[model samples]
Target: MHRAKLASFAFPDRPAGDAMSVIAPQAAVPRPVSRVLVVSGDAALTEQIVRGLNATAQRLDNPHGLVALAVAQVDQALARVGSDGELQVVLIDDGAADLAGSGPAADLAVQLAALRPELSLYRLLPADAGGSSGRRAFDGVAGEAIAGWFDRGEVDPVGWFRILAAEVAEKAATPFYDRLKAYVALAKDSWHTPGHAGGDAYLGSPWVADFHDFVGEELLRADLSVSVPMLDSLLHPGGVIAQAQQLAARAFGARRTYFVTNGSSTSNKVICQTLLAPGDTLLLDRNCHKSVHHAVILSGARPVYLDSSVQPHLGLFGPVPQVRLLQAIEAHPQARALILTSCTYDGLRYDLAPIVAAAHARGIKVVVDEAWYAHARFHPELRPTALECGADYVTQSTHKVLSAFSQAAMIHVNDPDFDAHLFRENFNMHASTSPQYALIASLDVARRQAVMEGWRLLDRSLRFAAELREQIDATGAFRVLTLDELLADEVRGDGIRLDPTKLTIDIGASGWNADELARVLLERHNIQIEKATHRTLTLLVTMGTTRSKVSRLMDAMQRLAREARSRAPASRPVPRRLPELPHFNRLACLPRDAFYEAGERLPLLDDSGQPNAALIDRVCCDQIVPYPPGIPVLVPGQVIDVAALTYLVRLLRTQQATDLHGLADVDGERQLRVLRREEAAPGLAPAV
Candidate 1:
């Protein structure tokens, strides 16, 4: 059994800049764990080796003191190695070693080394005098070699054991960063696409000069084109860009990971284009981003949407019920792929292990839209990641929850079963030929941060989340959803656990609802949340969230609960029941067909001054999507109904800024774009 606890293995206190210093002293608490794993038949010799390891490790300032796992055979060794995240080295006694596998000692050692790339391996041979039990049995030139491995003194040479090192280590190894630095040093002439190359072009221009200064000369200097050979090309990476991707793939536990500079929106489109085709069934969840619908429209895929389950009291869509997934799979078994959103905008995640297994059994490919879950894999407390849950394809917005710059995302592929050549072609189609070098670097370093510092940062983030939840709960006016609530009898087996970082506060039953609550927080308290729904408001906490900001928010909520609701406007209309999303049967044709067909624009309301729900045989040619939820109420070719109108009207009335998209008013006319009634035949091919 793995004895090391992540709780105890928390890196020791180091100087402010030494972020990669896992071995350092802290007088407050000296945790245990020195040596990683030791394999030997002799009890005394193993003890001596453990003692030697502890002496060196403790002196080097490791808080986790003297950790040594003595396994008699390789089976137990592999199990121990796999289970422990703190393993650093492995030593085998070749003489009396009863290895777990059926192989020679050297072969067994090689096999164990393959288990973890970071683990150092050594073999203990017979001594000259006392055959197996000498005091110097563990001492030799080989023993010196064993000590030499530890004595090299660096904790993790590859930088995998820690988060982003404050300073990128000075080595010949970092290809991408090295190339960029060298290119910037040259300060060469630029005949590039970006007009402000080297910031000289903006120097004399009146309006652009101030903006150029604001952006800084150094930044523009590094924003070089793909034509620069040393800097490497994103379109067809060979030198540095390819190496960076491989490093990230290994760090994130994926077979391969493609970096995207254009955010997960383009990443989603690439995945769709690669795995799906025109008329191919795509089992999609209705509660996905607007970008997903666009992908469907672009690919002309036949969509079979999963029934969205609602959190009745909260007005949020809960996880798709297990039965709903089963029914969809049974109905659309011919579907080429399935895409599910885990850790969605409001922080709901399905237990995907079982679902992925069930789909894979039927030869179905699974893709999880994990745009908000790049930091999930680093923490044990969080829900398991898409790759961990056996998805064939997964996309993550690295910038969302991790430390990457905005618009930077990662697409991880685990499918040895699909066409690699086709996937590469599709990736090139969506990804820009000349990507921003900074964005690519941000993703590279973000992956490093997630691997190295993720645990530390996430631990702090979760702790902060718990504090907010507690503070909010204490007020007794505002309420938050907990995993316990989702696990209760009426809601059990729905496969959900809240992302603690996404604090979804229920303000509906506070007698104030979301609009009034959001207004008071923004106008009076000067605190802004992410988005507010009819019944809820969401606040996103990432690695960068601080305790002080959280405290301010909590204090603001306390005041809002005690005074703001009662003191605020009174005539607020309580929202009616949230309308169920329009089903697939409501469509006149596939989304792509309506998307390209000739569309007519008409007033959203009738001449009698009401919603034009009574319009004679008009099909919606736009995805009527509100901003916060962004899930379309009706996609192209879908028949708009009274229920859809009811939801839209209530949504507009309660929302603070009232952001509605897709359908718009055209020049003094409140308009709805629809397939013209005259040509609205159900199966008519779109006029290309």
Candidate 2:
């Protein structure tokens, strides 16, 4: 059993306050050191070594500066170094062995030589020198002793300098396209990205014949491998892939840009992992997409949730108030960053500048989930993007509103001081091992489309939204929630944010439930609104909508509302509070842990007191989640919350609900797998 311990010292000890420190000049070392390559697994350690090298340069009275590139993974570092170079001091982090269990230090040394021929490499003993908080189980060496290895000619200085110089030279001269091409070849299209592989017509469904004809064959041909000639390599590259990424960086006003193939879900995780560690605290908006919450779990970081203002009448979450973020950071002074969603799903936009300024006041980084606001950068009227608001990391999902295919996204680092290397490392770790070439090509073209015609396209879209809103109001049967109603004094506190792009039609006063209205519309007219709830039916509009489509939607909504009002009013219990999303405090076991942990299957009522880890067994396979809002009623690692239970029971009672095939039937079946009571007795090992 892993027993949790109280916090004694969050950080390791440093040199005792330097109370009696003395400055001494060290002996001069050998010359001809033009470059230095510091190879380490830990980025923080690499930073310390760079600082140390600057000190070393000053002490040696050397005029030439050392250029360093620190990569977390050894494979990546080796790939970065060129064949023509000689290395001065190749410093490997002691923790690097855990990166992948290859072998002992001797084996590691040999592998290093194989990667770069005739290189002088030296391993630094992790002691107080690097200031690592974790246990250092390697050779016992002190800070002065580690520094001695560098200053006292313990390694071949001339060879080390040659290797580092060669690596640096290669990095400087390598073209981005070449790297991209290599990555394309290395990437084999699996069942992963680009659900369509090379646009092979044979594999496509007959129903997609028209789509295939509409989108040309050239588009598919260009969807070649990311490993193709001179493409930017995912692991390491210097070619067109690099050029494309660089172009994106320039277009987005970012220092660097990373193409994300796994959509905003992965993008969220990458941002969290790159900027924060286990001990760091993050301020999160309560209405954040489930992705941010998942990232927090993966990163092992605690979060201070800033509840966004919700519109009770509208039945939607709003953007977080700027003041709440300030209060949160002020309360948790040590918070490293704040994450917020720019424009919510309902199309309500939040001004991000004030929030950014507040977070930056205390040197805290701001990350914006601009997934829904992908068109914001293109449209001047939209809320300021993460770049415009001066956020450190901005994540955009191209597929949400843009023409790019699904699972397509990008992460931009806006700050100069932001760690590009760390971002790449974390991104590479969580991202797909084998990326789809189609997505890379799509992202390349998507950036061009967004930049060239985004503003013009969005302007048309805004006009269409306005026209639709007007028509919905014209229909006396249903009232469209307008700007006045949303901003009214009485509704201001109840309603937090409003996005004009969405057509949120209120069916509450029309004597019909939102669900009934939605069903009637779909059945009567061949038109469908998004999911409906008890109060409202939301309609989403993007670049895909035309004036004709809007007219038809208004016609259908008007007819449905009229038909609903003609019927007798049905009496039902009014829910006072909106459904609360589930929260998890601890993981009884990892996904793999729960897979292997022993437990028993029992009825749902009998298993209430027993600990349970949600798994993918047939009984638990069907995720009994609310449909309109797809928040999981019971997540994989959480003890089912009270809301979840009530929601499940209510969902079963509400036969009109479309989703929940499994849980709705759970009432009849007395079955659930949980920890056995006797096995979970005090002082005994828990069964789960």
Candidate 3:
């Protein structure tokens, strides 16, 4: 019998000036225990395997030892697997040769496979088990579900322990990140495009040396170019980049995954262009991000807008009514695609499974912009993500909630007939030719981190959010908006769910408007919130949110409440209310044509400082979107109406810290871009 020896864990040495050497001086962090669950009614066999694993850890001088837990009942095992995020492996003891011929044991195996596909499953065979018969049984019973089988008669217990450790380590590997780090350790001479030349340019000059010191040397050194063949090219990825994307696809439950260095904005455009062509009809959410409107214009798609419910008092917009969406789908049977944003900026998610099914039945592709819900798939409580709910294409801003750097995003494809060649052509059109290597590497590491520790991190975040909500409500001055409050009456029975991590607090009774509270929190307390509306403030409790951060925010709120109460009562001015969001208006022409046509900027207000009513009936040549929730009020080609103009005027008059895009400030007046009189005429046919 050949015996395998455990290798000592050590990093390779790098040269003195190497980037690795500069950053490698650090203390050794302790590793967490590798936990394995054993399913068997036989106590004696379980004990033997557990002891062997512990003894092997001791002999190898492993910092963190191995621990095996045995659960006899199937229900107990399932509970442990679901609750314990640290579990790495599962060993099922099939006493008889027939692993599948049983009651609870077989059922346990099936449940584990479905619940945790990341787990490494190994079957424990009897001592006398041998030959092709045992192998055949294992394969036939679970197929690829069972990773491998261990025969007690053939191998010693140490070998079994080693195999389990190896599996855990494999899950923790960051392919692109590890390779990038290794290449940096080489300290090779650089004649790269980046004039910094591995930061030597900055370091060599006395004037810029301070800047280099401030930014750190490792970042510039790791910023290598495609000239270095080892780091691989983002545009034509066949190496570690491909492997990383494959891992991400599996982790995110998609057929294929593509890394986006540019943000979900670009991802939205790429998907839209790939799916739609000139004159194609699309059903789009009226409250979608500005990027979706840009996509509609760029793709030359004629959009049939679906109206979203608006909370006028709260200054918020919710998801489209289920009845309205279904009606739109039925009305537009020739529509090529349906696009919507799940989990709106304030965290209201649609019941997407039925919606996806409805779209698919009509041969319409469904694209879900899940830019804020990237962390949804990691926890069971957040299941049924857009992709899991059968979306054809889903775009996620990984950097928004995950550990990835800014501008890092991902596009997941789950279409049955996904055109790889056509999709790649469109993706390359939006993708930068010279991509940032560090951003790509971050995407790789982000996937590994999410796969390994996401459940544990999200569990902590959910708990913190819950505690904060209760404590904040106890203040009485401010109340956290519950699921019932966030959902509109129209979407009550539509099976919509609000993400608990998003805490929207109504600050009406706090004696301060949302803008005032946000400013005070930032200026006095040095705390910045996610979004603020007229009467409500939205705070995102993500995986990165800590207990200390939550406590500080609560303390600030309590102090502000007390201060407001102590002050003498004054004549409180009535806060200005935002106008109701306008419904989808009839387009005078196609969005693409109106956008590309000759246009002139018209002042929103006339000389008397009143709204220029002349601009009301004119066709808009640009999108008028209010930032924070970057939803467009007037998309290109849409004819301006009283309701839409009122919304814009109120927003400008209030000056409520909301950014107005596509509307410009010219010669001390807010201007709206509109098409010429001839071009704005109605009944224009689609350009051939």
Candidate 4:
């Protein structure tokens, strides 16, 4: 039996003086009960176990009470457990052998474990069964799924209760966050580098008092600095921060995990800097985030771009075909690393196991940018995560899908040859010495939350998305993009999967472009979507998504559909044709060289407002990226072609709502940065 005393601490939100002023004895607050579900067809056995648990709870004077409910069928047990967030332990009666190895009960246990990995499952055996020497113990999946087994006649209820209490306490611990809260409760005066000195600068001034008040006193007070040695230094963690990171590593299934406060973008850059050197070859996914492109430039790696299948109709880019990816690995055997994004922005996931295996065979490291897939490892349905696929390094934006503040991310290392000292140096290069203590605490708390309830939260989000997809599809004016619709013909049978939580709705039938519909939804219905293309809107169903939000979104979509149907034929808007996405295949020089070289901005259009064909073959010196899907259309050192230039011209003319990053407005005309003509050496061979 394990018993750990719970820590007693004052709430950080309460003033220090108030904590000291409370001297009177107060009534004991009701402790939350630990819910246990007993699955058994025998009423007598069920009552016996429930009575024992209740009596044990009373006898021990448990700080947390106990409640047990019995369900006859495995289906009912599963349903109850799924819906009850407080339920922790499950006891199944297997005396009848109905739930013996590989039976329905065994399957139910596996599913319940997946839905709540922290849940404790035990099998109840008959008294004589344990004494039978010929009886074989549970084996295989059933044996592994169950936490323990108990013979009813010899059951130790008090021991079981203590074990449950210890497990709960372990999962509830957030080392860094708890310490931060306790330190804040001390009400220590700060004379640190932060000039605000715990918001005193703002609170004392009338000019900024409103701003400070709006931001709240608790947040301001908790905004601490490195001067407080107890909080531990992020760069050289040896205390609570180190413990928090180790806990996160165990939760996320990483060999080692490092918390990153500068978002996954910086995480990618740090990894790149640590792994790659100038002139090293890299195999990269073309559909990756712009941050990857920036990493290439900063690391000075020679990139061999892998083509992603394009869906011209929906303006979407699918994952690289498995065949193409494998062939690229073979072709670029000299490549130092292979980096790709799993669960692309629209939620297209690649079967990375084979891909990672192939990359490893060639002595090339695999780095997966799972920036939007922080919750993938927590659920069984979302298994085969990058780490599980043998990736050397994985970067995740915890804030995107989990309960963390923005810019909070993590870098997970599983490399066989990872050099901690070198990685730490690179991490410190990108990390700020004056890091936000609140953000770090948020990361610590986020890890604890995910470990405790990630499966339940994800299960709810998946169901919500499914319900919304069906409702939206029935609206006639809109239809959710199924896997078949999202995948291009070339990559149809590539073992690709769609994340059900990400819904991409095709709104072509609604008679409104995606931008117009998004604006209407935000303005009229107070609803905001994740991203929008010309004819589709993508919505993310995250842990934060609620039933009320799902219902409100459906209601808004139905109203829009009705309005579309009522509109006159002449009033219905015509759909606009978008240009095919351009490919960045022409590498005239090294990206590092071109980016560092002298460049001049030239008008994209002539006086007549037509594209200046003269600039077609010029070498681009900067990245020209489209905003919604932040993939760069033209990267540095690429020789601009007619197709690429025409696509840019079309976007400038028709897609005024789209933001082109590298284009500048000079004399009221859009211009691009290109290397000087003299600098474009003659007969320069393509780098790729």
* Per-residue accuracy of model 2 over 1-688 as CA lDDT, tens digit each: 2323333322211135733213324323323333455666555667766665655555554433454445666565555543213233356555444533445433445555433322345555444434343223323422211221232212333444444444433322323433434444564553433546656653357787556556654455445444444455655546566777776775566788888888999999989888778647778776677778667667756566565655555546566655566677777767788888877666665666776787788888889888877776655456456687788888989887887778989888887577767777887898766676667766776776555445445667777888877777776667667654544243244234555667777665677656666777788787788666557667877777776677678778677667665766555334323444444232332222222234455444435533222422221222334554544454333344454555555554553453552243355653444433333211211111
The parts of candidate 4 lying over 4 Å away from their true place are 1-53, 59-155, 677-688
TM-score of each: 0.76, 0.59, 0.90, 0.85
Model 1 segments more than 4 A misplaced: 1-174, 202-209, 484-491, 509-527, 565-584, 613-617, 649-658, 677-688
lDDT of 3 by residue, 411-465 (tens): 9999998999999999988898788888988898888878777887788889899
- What's model 1's overall lDDT? 0.70
- Please identify model 2 stretches exceeding 4 Å from their true place: 1-223, 234-237, 321-323, 483-497, 519-524, 565-627, 630-688
What digit string (tens of lDDT, one per residue) describes model 4 on residues 1-688? 2323334432222224543322324423435556778888777777877787788877776664566778887777777876775676798777645442335556676777666556778877777767444124555655655776677666676776777666666656789999999998999998886787777888667688777767766788889889999999999999999999988887787889999998999999999989999888888988888888998888888888877888878878889889988998998899999999998988899999999999999999999999988998776667768897899999999999999999999999999999899999999998999999899999998987787667777888888888998999999999999999999999998989988888999988888868889999999999999888888899999988877688789999999999989988787776665678876566877787788887988888877888888788888889998774567788888888888888888887787677899888876788988999778533334543
Superposed by TM-score, candidate 1 places the C-alpha of residue 101 at a distance from the truth, in angstroms, of 19
Ranking by TM-score: 3, 4, 1, 2
Q: lDDT at 157 for candidate 2?
A: 37
> Where is the poorest 10-residue window by lDDT in model 3?
6-15
Model 3 TM-score relative to the real fold: 0.90
Candidate models: Cα lDDT each:
0.70, 0.58, 0.81, 0.82
The per-residue C-alpha lDDT of model 1 at residue 366 equals 92
RMSD of each: 9.7, 22.3, 7.1, 7.3
